[model samples]
Target: MLQSLEIELTSNKKQQPAADQLGFGNHFTDHMFIMDYSTDNGWHKPRIQPYQPIVLDPAAKVFHYGQTIFEGLKAYKTDDGRVLLFRPHKNIQRMNRSNERLSVPELNVDVVIEALKQLISVDKDWIPTAPSTSLYIRPFIIATQPQLGVAPSTHYQFIIIMSPVGAYYTEGVNPVKIFVESEYVRSVKGGVGEAKTAGNYAAGLKAQEIAKEKGYSQVLWLDGVHRKYIEEVGSMNVFFKLKGVVHTPALNGSILDGVTRNSIIQLLKHWNIEVIERPITIEELYKASQNGELEEAFGTGTAAVISPIGELNWQDDVLIINDGKTGELSKKLYDTLTGIQMGKLEDPLGWMVEATPVNV
Candidate 1:
């Protein structure tokens, strides 16, 4: 295990927001976890201090080369006032994968996980107890070396920030309309698509902006090479259920391996439902919709958990799924997952990690 982190309490605690008004990532807690990295010292100076603005050099490598990675997970306040983190280790592992891909220094997963537990314990009161509300945890790393070169930075900063968020999308588990992008591609094979890096999301702003103006909630991205195979939705992994069998795009070189997507697949198999992971083309999906084979469709991610895709507009050809409503399977998966998350259901997979309470 890494060294214990130094705790610095803040005297000024901001007024907590009402649970009903806690939208996604709008408010922050009073404290944050931070650690520094260097070639000589490795990762050191782990501390939990007041949440404040970070100062960086003008020519920091992160600003010039876009060398930053982030991971999202949540801590739920159970009915009994206990805080629980779902599948946090998996998120840290994925962060390491992103670091390797982005040429950033990998973090000690065990150390970071402990830091998260401690930080959340300190700010446990910020976890919202309202329905569908939780504290969103953002763990990120950035290259901080003050240089204007293309190479990876020798200095780095790993930080964990918490936000009391309600839902990622305004629809909040309701069905959402998606527009297929044929003009701009998000990422390509052998690119940083699989990595949870800022550049990947930055590259998608144009297409997302266009889709929003077109009255769509998100964009359904296709494969970069063929521009026909369905890769993923804007921030979630897409899934389709046809003829009682679930289908989701395989984790090819470009697509992200989502934790929620993997959990859904495991849940389906646990219930003996058929699930397949492969390259699914838009033509096949449209044909299935026409033949009534497409029964349900949804997207999985940490933010929304399971967002039902009610309609897909591809090149002006709109495909309304399940009568533009949430599907049965989608609702079931959402309930089960959220149930386990909120401590209402039995955790058969032992996915919940209890955050030990710390005296404030």
Candidate 2:
């Protein structure tokens, strides 16, 4: 068991927004969890305090060197008023992997999880109760040592904040059009692509912006070297259903090990579906589409859960998938995953971790 965390309630509780208007990442909870680290003291002063701006020196290492990592998860409020966190341990484990890649201090998963439970208990009311809505949790670590000489910082800060959010994409669960990016690459082999760091996302902004301008929802990135192998979507893992089989890009040191991606693979296997993780080139996918073998396409992530891809725009060829409608398998996976997350389905995998009850 971990030590108890200090709680400091806020005097001003922000008014919660209506369920329909609770767009993605617009509103934050009243309290946030924080812990500090140093080379000498390690992690200390775990607490839940009022949500406020953090004060850091302008010359902090994070500002110059970009030594930071983050993880995204959600807290669902069940119909019976119980808060459920899905596969939170997996997210923390990935966070530690990101820390290792970024040269930051590793965190104790158990202690951080305990802190998250305490923080959620204090601000449980912030969790949305509407369908397809939940409290998005963001945990991150940043190097804080003011003197930035390129080496790893001696001081770091770990923080967790909650935001009540709806769908990540404006299209929600509807099928969206994606542009296959050819000019810019998101990551490469032996790079920081697999790590959940800010720089990786920052590097994709240019490609994403170009895709958006061309009337697409997201960019489907290809391999950096060959630029023909399908990698992933802008913020999610990409999957292709061809000839009654599911294929996703292999985690070849470039693709992120997404929690939702892993869960979907597990669920598919449980249903006796053939799921293959290997290098899938865009040419092969286009050939399958031409042969009417490409049945469905979707992207998986915490923010959107499962987003169906209706159209893929690669060069001058446009392949419309499943008649621009959601696929049967996509709908089934979305319903099953969301049902399990919302406490409506039997959790055979035991992925949901219940938060401590809140008195208020």
Candidate 3:
């Protein structure tokens, strides 16, 4: 374990109702953890200050170059009232990988974890007790050096903030519709698609809005070059069940390697399920859906543990999955995953990290 961080706690005295709602990232806790980085000073000036707006120069490198990266994870309040985090180290490691891609300096994994622990320890009351609800932690890095040049900023700020959030899907754990994009592409071989950067999502919003207008919940992105191999769904990694086996797109530069997705693959493989990490094409998925071989499909992310895909709208054609209901495998996977998260089942994978207890 790393050394615990020194924090200054500030309570959100008046706005208690907003925190109680936990409707995703709408409300924030009173305090946040922040650290600064520079080429000379490295990472310094760690503090837990009141949740407030950050002042950045108009000519900051991040403002122009868009050199920013972020990671999302959750803190869960168990039935025993103990708060815990699910695989935070995975997020830290992935954030470092994202930093390397975005030309940002990397923080030590232990330091990142300690910073998160400090933030959660100060805002433990923000962790909701409702079923399937948790405190979502957003940790991000940004270039702060005020330079108009198109180079990486020498100064940076890393911060972690907490938001009490409800379940992502309001329609319960039911199935969702996906729009297969044969036209718009998300990432190419040399692109920054694998990194959790802000620009990637900013570029995806237009397509996502179009998807919503077309009666689809999310867009299933394909490779930019070939436009054949499936990459990932919007903001989530995708999994396909065919021939009683699990198949997902390989981590081939364009896919975001989700912590939940990796965990599900490991869980399936542990149960002797043949889980293949390979290139699955949209045509292949369509064929499987038509021939009754497609058993299940779901998208996995920190926000949405697992969202079952009930239908796929590809242009004029429609493909239904498992009779347009949550399949057996989808239910089992979701139950097992959430069971471990809510502390109702054994955490054999040792993914849960209990937060330091504090009375609100």
Candidate 4:
């Protein structure tokens, strides 16, 4: 384990992007966090340096075998100029889970969280203060051993990059239409679906492309094997409000146990709302939708917080939900979560963490 964190400030800084034009993942911050790992030396050479392109060998294992893991989070600027991180510890823990599943070396949770704080502090000005805007943080580990063998690489690089992004939904939380993918299956049980890895996303690109062509915002993936059970909605965990109960799919090794998903469950419980976690079939959901039992549907994740589902197209049958508008509960949840995240509301759950500067 590396104890000392070396800091190298950038000699030349680029012009910052205007908050209004700060699209998602377009512009990067001035500095980034990077750490190297090897079988013999363990994790070492932790440093914060200028954001630049990484140089890896042409035969790197990540390029050939797809051994990489990543995690996404954000930092918010409060009215009083304090930088806040929402549930950053949860993301750090998930990053290690992804590393374990990808055969990559696990990161020290505390040290990695500290690295995030220090890195964000170094470039704290990059955090946007516009409405629903934030500095997106991406931490990833890639197999860099330049080996052609179909095995875990002996070397890895853990890197953290920051990008200032605007709100996910510009004109309020209008629901998005989802396309149910019948041809392409995302992941099955005992697969890498649960991990935040690059391969799982790579596998979804075809389906996503198809959905985009069909005039849908994203693809709602069902279970790969049975193709009946609802697994996840795009990159986020899904929820359906049927009758008066809220139902979300259980973590069955094939679905990502999202941080936002867990937080939403907790919040519902805190609010005394009936929430259940179990296997839900697509047919069941469709039947409920047909009978007008399904009141609202939404997807929860770090990016959108709450993306309400206005319609679901399965085999050309479009099921309009909540009158093709955002639900009241979805709006409330989004408002509360964003308020807490931006240090505007009382975080009774203690989810936000401040990245305080120490005269860096």
Better of 3 and 4 by TM-score: 4
**Relative to the unseen true structure, what is the C-alpha lDDT of residue 235 in candidate 3, on a scale of 0 to 100?**
90
Going through the candidates in the order shown, the clash numbers are: 0, 0, 0, 0
lDDT by residue (tens digit), candidate 3, 218-243: 89888898888988888999999999
- Candidate 4 per-residue lDDT over residues 82-192, each given as its tens digit: 889989999989988888888899888989998988999899888889887899999999999998989999999999999999866553478999999888988999899
| Model 2 lDDT tens row, 1-360 | 246577889999999999999999999999999899999999998888999999999999999999999999999989988899999999999999999998999999999888898889999989998889999999999999999598999999999999999999989999999999999999999999999999999999998988999999999999999999999998899999999999999999999999999999999999999999999999999999999999999999999999999999999589999999999999999999999999999998889999946552
Ranking by TM-score: 1, 2, 4, 3
lDDT of 2: 0.94
Q: Each model's RMSD to truth, in Å?
A: 0.9, 1.1, 2.0, 1.1
Q: Flag regions of model 1 displaced more than 4 Å.
A: none
**Residue 310, candidate 2: C-alpha displacement in angstroms:** 0.4
Which lDDT value does model 2 have at 348? 80
Q: List the residue pairs that clash in candidate 4.
A: none
lDDT of 1 by residue, 69-123 (tens): 9999999988887889999999999999999998888888888998998899889
**What TM-score number comes out for model 3?**
0.96
Alpha carbon lDDT of each predicted model: 0.94, 0.94, 0.86, 0.91
Question: Using Cα atoms with residue i matched to residue i, what is each candidate's TM-score against the true structure?
Answer: 0.99, 0.98, 0.96, 0.98
